[model samples]
Target: MNPSIKKLSDIAQKTSKTIIGLMSGTSLDGLDIALCEISGIGPSTKVELKNFASVPYDSAFKNRLKAITSVPNVSLQEVTLMHTYLGNYHGELILKCLRKWAVAPSEIDCIASHGQTIFHAPKQQHNQPQMPNATLQIGDGDHIAHKTSILTISDFRQKHTAAGGEGAPMAGFIDEMLFTHDTEDRIVLNIGGIANFTYLPAKSKDRPSITTDTGPGNTLIDAAVRQLFSKEFDQDGKIAKHGSVNADALAAFKSDPYFRKPLPKTTGPEFFNLHWVENKLSKAGITNVSNDDFVATLTRLTAETIAESIKSILDDKSHPPLYVSGGGFHNPVLMDWLRKLLPDITISSFENLGFNPDAKEAVVFAVLANEMLAGEGFKMESAQTENISFGKISFPN
Candidate 1:
């Protein structure tokens, strides 16, 4: 057996485990490094977001990722170089976070990494006949383990894809594990670069719960901001606040076939990038709109799509309280829109559930690593659903 597997086995026998969970979302912002202290597993799990930090990627690195995102045809050499480089990059960031927190790598039980997503192509995304749903995330796990000298679990999405999921929102597992209730229906909405949610019914089961990508979240907004304003993102949604939303443009944006698709669907920047926005704008014949108005419309587009998704899933009388997380909650304009659109239900942040909204995604990986250590696997009702023991183990020399 692998030495890392032996270590994981030993760690599970202990009373508690400390782990580091790292995530780099599609936004290309940076790596979210979360040092978590967790105990137990499944519904009995207890998690503490011990230390959290987001190490921003420099201009050069960000540019490279953006190039790969915008340009379809990338050289094999670039992909290979980024895969190795990002692993070491992530490992170094881990060390920096540890030193800053006054912790030791040897003290950490394991590291669960949601590696950088290079390309995400669900069968639906491609609409290609006879092609399997596939996704790719590159950042060598062996490199992470070798550099950090800790047992590492990485490339979690592959198991989901292999098990017949789109491999986009693996957050459902952690959301259900952490947020499920016995009496009240709850929806855990994550507004990252792409919006996704996990709807936990009042009753629980071993089967896959309701989970799907709502639509574009911050990806389109961020792209528009970068192209028009030369800013990384609309800070506090100030740009959006400054301008009025073009209702006609917003209506046109919402007419995409993907939005009308049934639940359990997924999408990415590859589908909702600047080109999508530009096409909608051109179709609506709105060329002279100010950058602020464009941002405002994009913000409204997100809110409308999210509200429409909620309406599609639940009856008008069935109002479930929503627990929001991810980068989108910080956007005042988006939050304001949701509050207005979802007045029937209580809308709050994940902080009320004892988890930092920003650290939620990172914490999920930590919990997943804990599950891997415990030798636990899950089963869902549908064989086509994602149900498995996720994460690939890597050893340190």
Candidate 2:
């Protein structure tokens, strides 16, 4: 047997494994590195988030990435080069983080990397009968494995697309495993560049789970801020808190056909981008709105859309508390709007459940890698992501 295969076999039989999970969301803010010690499998699975960090991307690097991501056209050569460059860069970042934390590469069993998503084209978005549900996430697993000298599992979304999924919001597997409660139904909401959630029915209820995108989260707000306020994000939602929402602009934004789509659908910044927002503004004939008001309206749009999605999943009598994790959780104004919109539903941070909201996505990737190595298969209440194993594994020679 190859030495790498033998090592993998040994690691699989171990009582516990240490894996470093990496996530670079569409926000392009940074790479989230989560050092996780995971044990067991399925419902018996357990994880300890030993260390976590967000290594921010510099302006030049971010610009280069933005130039290639989610656009209609791009240089193929640039895309190819970036695919390799990002993997190596992420490997170096992991090594640096390990060194900073006084750990060696040999101590880590695997690196589960959610590579940068340049484009996500589900059949719904593309309207191509010929193409299956397609999506692409760059940053090569082979490069990561070779550079980090650790077993790497990357491009997990391909497996989902191959298995007849929309290739997104893979949060259901981990969310179900980690957050499901026996007595209380839970909604594990991740408000990233594109907001999504996993509806984990109470174990006692025997209801099927549902996971879907809830439209924009911080994508529009961040893009508008960068162009207008010249900031990366609305820190604590200060701009939105002061500004008033324009009802006309809000209605125009909500008029999108995507919002009318059925549940279990997926979308990305590719659809809910700056251009989309600008077109909505033009349709609303709101040219002279204050920047703060624009931000506030966008923020309100996010809150309302998310609230509507959450409400759509619940019955009149059942109001499952929403435990939110991701960038939007930090925005007080967004949180405030959600509370106001859904007065009956309880809303709080995932921290209430003993996990770092920022680290949750990365940590979930780590859990996925663990299941791929030692578990039977990905089992979830949602059939949309069940009975499948994700991630293409790369062995370090």
Best model per TM-score: 2
Residue 348, candidate 1: how far off, in angstroms?
A: 1.3
**What is the alpha-carbon lDDT of model 2 when measured against the actual structure?**
0.92
Off by over 4 Å in 2: 379-386
Q: Residues 1-397, candidate 1, lDDT per residue (tens digit)?
A: 9765677678878778999999899999999998888888777888888889988999789999777663468988998998999999999999988999999899998899989998899898888969878889999999999999998999988887777777877788888887888777899999999999998887543434688899999999998999999999999999999999988888889888888899978988888988888898898787888889999999999998998898788886889899999999999999999989988979999899888888889998888888877746666443464548889988887
Q: Give Cα-based local distance difference scores for all models.
A: 0.87, 0.92
Where is the poorest 10-residue window by lDDT in model 2? 378-387
Q: Write the per-residue lDDT of candidate 2 for residues 99-118, one digit (tens) a residue.
A: 99999999999999999999
Global CA lDDT computed for model 1: 0.87
Q: lDDT, candidate 2, residue 39? A: 90
TM-score of each: 0.95, 0.97
Cα distance off (Å), candidate 2, residue 170? 0.3
* Poorest 10 consecutive residues by lDDT, candidate 1: 378-387
Q: Please give the distance, in angstroms, between residue 112's alpha carbon in candidate 1 and its true position after superposition.
A: 0.2
